[model samples]
Target chain A: MGFEMFAVFPGCTLEKYSSELKEPLIKILKYLGIEWIDLGGRCCGMPLLLSGDSESFREVIRSNTDYLRNVVVITSCAGCFRVFREYYSGFMVKHLSQFILDLGFSSFPHKVDLRAVYHDPCELIRCRVAEEPRELLRRIPGLSLSEFKLNRESSTCCGGGGLVKAIFPSLAVEVAYEKILRELPQDVDAIVSSCPFCYLNFKDAASIYSLNIKVYDIIHILGMALGVL
Target chain B: MFDNVFQTYKLRLYEAMDNSFIRAALRRAVDSFRINRDKALKRYSDVEDKRLRLIEVKKHVLSNLESYVKQTMESIESNNSYAYYAKSINDALKIIDEVIGSGKMIVKSKSITSEELNLNYNLKLKGNIVYETDLGELIIQLLDSKPMHILSPAIHVPKEKVAELFSKISGENLPPDIPKLTMFARSFLRDKFFKADIGISGANAIVANTGSIVLIENEGNARYVSNTPPKYVVIAGLEKILPTLIDATILVEVVSRYASYYMPSFVSIISGPSKTGDIEKTQVLGVHGPREVHIILLDNGRSEVARDPLFSQALYCIRCGACLYECPIYQLVAGNFGYTYFGGVGAIWTAFIDRELHYASLIAFTCTLCGRCKVKCPMNIDTPEMILKLRESIHSIKLIPEPIRQIIENVKKYGSPYGLTNRFL
Candidate 1:
């Protein structure tokens, strides 16, 4: 397969939601000219792990453990990146955001000229994920970022967790938009997240005509950067 | 009326607080209230088990409320007590009128359903004298105000105002000393037990099999209200029913511990108005309880809630108000943040109970959604998430205002949230 898996999407990424970020992910790969095996990466299955369904999750981990051998797992999601970095053995996982920064593509592909508040999704900051996304975004020329009064571990949930969506969908959107709208500086462009669940939930909430903030995944920002439609 | 409801719940709470009397009165009760809950839960080890059982009981009742209501109505009728299901608030008031007719001095216990139905004002218009026997309720009644918190009705009223109320109600110039004020009210309400013709109370839980209405209160006013009068009316929201007395008893434990009762304070299980059949089991009303016991099972907004998977859990709330006290944001703003409901979870409730509220969206944004309230909530109500869902409904429903809609449109088009000119640009 000779694939250089540079990143991974963590479990519960619900990757089906984003067609916008795929080609750009591939384009950035094409620009860097690295082999990207986008699929067959098993879900980190952390949602089940956190919910106390570790037996099934261990089975998943065992099955996926073989795939990561001798290959780098590249992920646009910080959650996936954190899982591989912290838990999984015999795999290489680098976050797409930091990878772009390392590749100097944060400056090269496109400059998304916006002053926005970057939110650290719960798992991304308090969990094993690195602070590299923040470090990388700050380095990107002309990408102005402001900190929320409360972020990182102190950051709020969008109310879209723990199978809360299937059980309670309205609450997911309600709390997501609430957290998104909180800490508005009276002047800011939008809210951005490293997690796709947060990104998508916040995006749907943003579309609801009550919240005035836009939501974006980091890969989408990179999509804008890499000049892939 | 809907507009005033928003004012009463949102704006007026702050306006009432500005006088400092409300704040002082609230502080007087708040500490004591928090202490009771802390002490009670500490004493009870199996409290969580009880809560879980209660949750299971409530789940069964809510899942099969239609059949349970049918069962409850039949049993009460057999026991010579009457049952009327009011699908709406108006219907409940009308049914209440058939029982009361006119010229009645009512000694009622605490009923949030009655408050929801606005029955006191309706009955008062019909020229009936109504006195609230629940100590907390009495304070709110004397103040001519609404409940600020669920358990403590006059939680917003400070002691100075209570002193003034005691001075006016008792005709004795009393100081704002909390014990003194409480003693005065106790003496005053102890007398209302004997003089009232009709007693109206709310059931904490109702058992379908036995047709028993369970009341859990610390003050025993509910017991007096249900027992002393010739005719007693139970006006409960339809969501209160449980399957059996055993299940209802388990819920009583949860309610007591979570509501901050050290021991099961006073559990009154009234079955069909105290009817006793001696020789032939000829059920007689008004033996140990009220002769004519009428229960108005209200639907008003509960059934609409039942249709939605999201908001239905709000009905599952056992009226514990533990969520309100545990809320960090609620600790700061109290009743002002949300409407009559209060706090982040209350904002979702306000939307469900009444849709026209404007402050709900404004208040919804106040929560950090730290998930602490859900952590403390015994039911695991997931209020933070519920608030978000309500926000979505409010935003996308086309019923929201245009400016808010424009703001949402900006999020989809630009990556920026506020539609601002990018400072980096």
Candidate 2:
């Protein structure tokens, strides 16, 4: 297989809220010997599209298209991945989980013992990337992944999408809290997902509700397994 | 204007959230719905195929809705039933008023269309006594509250609250036991069913070919409501029209399965008034059941929605309400997220049927635009897509909430919704 350079699009949520996931994301890419270029900090027009400001959405799309027109775009943000995959036609886009799975997980040299459950973000589920993240998690040494009763296509939202957090903050947090209470396995040490919004929402929900579980971006766990975190 | 809408919605949402009973009840109901729907759907391997076929049939019927309406009326008339097309809520109310007259007793099954028409209020104003037959609906009727869920209207009300309400109605101390409460309601409503001068119901599907009104229900109240009275009326949306009885059956099955039932206890198919030839081999009406059957197919902006290229797909909804349980926002706030209708699909229905885009504007924004509703819908209505289209229309009219408008501005100007000047490199 030939190593190809891809452009990394760190969507606004990742930059603002879950910036810690960025370092491990870069570390995993480096360990995999993949060359990448940062597309710089930018919005993926998701907010505009969600807000029904299609005119501004188109404008943002045009601006981003100029920079990303010729590259295979990779992003850890599920919202960005969904926007590019569904809306943009001229370029190819892959969620970081899909990108990593396609690159293959050949060897696992380090062990981080933990029992975790994988949350399927609404965007990744819409994009049909449910299995790739789970497959990646299974490859890590000493990490066990369990399934939510409602997983994949049936997975519920993390209550962080469609600007809900910005407008109805309490409702968003309540949704996340209900999901944790109802869906999270009692024995799991952590909940993992690739989407930055899910990461931020779950993190906030767990802390606010005094839930003792840890929340992690899949990259963080993967980086741990590969000795890159 | 935007501020008022948002504030009103926020207030209602917070009120619903503060009610811990409603929160707990909603959680239990949502969990059960999920489990039951998954189990019910798993029994049939061809669920997807059936759903697709129903979608095709719905699309075909909606495409030629005017023709189907004509055909349905003709077929219904031929079956010795009166058929009327109501282009608006006022027209439907007028027709209903004329049929039942004043000082009449009426028993009604769960009809969201009637809710749309505010049928009970209008009929009561005309001096008619109206009773809701479905237990949940009866609960709502007593509470003077709107439905909390499309299928389970009073799901937000806990058993203790129901016992209290029923206790007052029964003039006795009714226990909080489910069976006792149910029996009390049954005995209480049973007399109304017999004494009622008219029965009204909403059809799950109306077969154009056979002129049959198909209704699926678990409580058996609809059977009494449609049969016991001397006159019966069905007020249903024109979108319920199906080309044939077979298509209607398939649709009913899909509706039941997605509504968390393998099959409802009663699947009533009524074509026309009850008649018999037992006397002298000559067919005579008014035998055992209602002698007069009136079918009113309501348009009320359904035709306009059907003509819209972007939103026409919304008419494909079977009203299974699988989406409401699946909706993250609806799970938290229940029916506060909508106006007349509730949940993501309700936003579209509110905008069109209720013709209140101002209210629908806030409801549309309440949705997370997560595709859970679409994935769960047997009709695959794409409520999120419809909501986006509705939002666009609302935005053009400058009905967007201030927070959303600011976010959009920030995304356009600062390249981030947060409007941060510093970039993470």
Candidate 3:
């Protein structure tokens, strides 16, 4: 695959609850003149791993790898990026943030004049791709980024990983509440994260706590800054 | 099926969340531990290499647990100390009863193994007055509260609460001053140590080569308990064995680094019954420490855990409590997150030892499967992986929460986690 050719793995949340993340993401990629195929929605086998169905997880990875063969795969979800890069080796799977960084965007069509704090997804941090998301955020003109005291490798979990939201919502909410209380600056308007699961969780938690904060996937914010969405 | 357990767990969680004091206390404790852990690790320039070496040592020991146990038992016999294998908690208690015969007073240092066996309650029922010598354990023993943290048993209790609990025992109004509280506990426990007929302590690492036990602690009480009593009983898990004293020494470094981030105030290495040949060139037991040192190696499903390929790493835990301070769920619920032990590692151990499927299911599912515990663990025990394996077993039984089941089914059917492939509102 050439630099312009790519296949997109939007992941489960991106296909459904976070479809809004897709349009901005696609627009930004199109703006960069990168021709990409929409591989549509697919399970990244994380839920399978979480549920202790490694057999099914392996089977899923095998088939996903077959579909993603001979293509540069761009993943919107940090969870998907992790499973693809770690578990599947056939395709060159890169996080959308890392892909954008590689594209080397020198200027944006529009500046996103908003103060945002970058929340590192646990999957990305654990995989050592934390810098990619931060670099993506930094490229946005007129956007000021405030970091949590605990960021990168030591960054707190967004309380959304490991399918906790489905089974242990209360515990997940408490975790999110604690992370926000401890890490988030009170002045930030938005909590920008690289994972859809994290985005959904922070958004839910913001409402639960009645905090006037908007949560966005990095693609959404970056796309907004580029006047793509 | 586990509705009541989940209810109780949620109640405790909500109560913990509501209690500002407990949350703040946990945060402060974790911050200090993390800082200290970093400080302690900074002392060793090759800290990561040391951790990897410790991991290898534990892995090798766990894989050949039976051989190590045999070696440890033989070494203990050679040292003239009695070693017995207890198949169960009841068997261990029975052995203790037989050993004691007529002895009553007991002073015990901090031992999660003893907690696992509920030794204090059983000893008390047998009419043996048992005193917990560790300050945290003593505080919880007085308050009749379960241990919230592994290393710091009474971490959930604030200083003012400790002051309150101590004041009641002292029969005087005590200020919330920490030093005053420490003095009260010290004065209260000093007599018990001298009066106790037997001392019971847990082994951090049981050296198979020398048949010795290494105990790391900050308080002088463990030494007092082990040294002052005429008879000493060590109740340890069979999984505590190390191949040699050299390995055990390394473990002491690992445990202390992970536990308190400092080489503890004392690291007690007890080989056998204390012997002295001072008056004559003839050795005699009961010279300074205990006359008879009886070691009861408790199995209590450790063999079953060892047999399990997925969860065998659970045995690698040195009980440093590093995972607890690093666990997100534990930071919120404290000890209430688990039954006997605390955090993700505790959940795995409880699942194996408790033998109740419903109980284990509830505890196992509560873990978020975050890998922070894995990163922070000295042994790199993949507790989240173990929990997931437990969850998989639970999933087979269809005991998973309804909401979770729905999501799983949704993902299976609709190719989306939420089960909606259609347009969103």
Best by TM-score: 2
Q: Output the better candidate (2/3) by TM-score.
A: 2
**Model 1 misplacement above 4 A:** A1-229, B1-39, B276-284, B338-340, B354-367, B399-406, B423-425
lDDT string for model 2 (A1-229, tens) is 3544599987887666544876677777788887778875788889989888889889888888888866889998999999998888787898887887777666578997989999999888888888888888888888888989889988889898878888888888888888999889778999999898888899899999999899998878888888987
Query: Residue B327 deviation, candidate 2, in Å?
Result: 2.2
lDDT of 3 by residue, B174-243 (tens): 9999999999989998889988999999988888889998888888888998899999999999889888
Local accuracy of candidate 1 as per-residue lDDT tens digits, B143-253: 887777778777766778789888987777999998998888789877777778889888998888888889988888888899988899999877888888888777887
Across B216-312, the per-residue lDDT of candidate 2 in tens digits comes to 9999999999999999999999999999988988887888889989888999999999999997899999888999999999999999999888788
True contacts kept of each: 0.03, 0.69, 0.53
All candidates in order of DockQ, best leading = 2, 3, 1
Give the alpha carbon lDDT tens digit for every residue of A3-106 in model 3: 54589877777777544777677777787786778877777777776766566678777767777888889988888888887788867888888888888866
- Location of the lowest summed lDDT over 10 successive residues in candidate 1 chain A: A9-18
Error of 2 at B369 (Å): 2.2
> What global local distance difference test value does model 2 have?
0.88
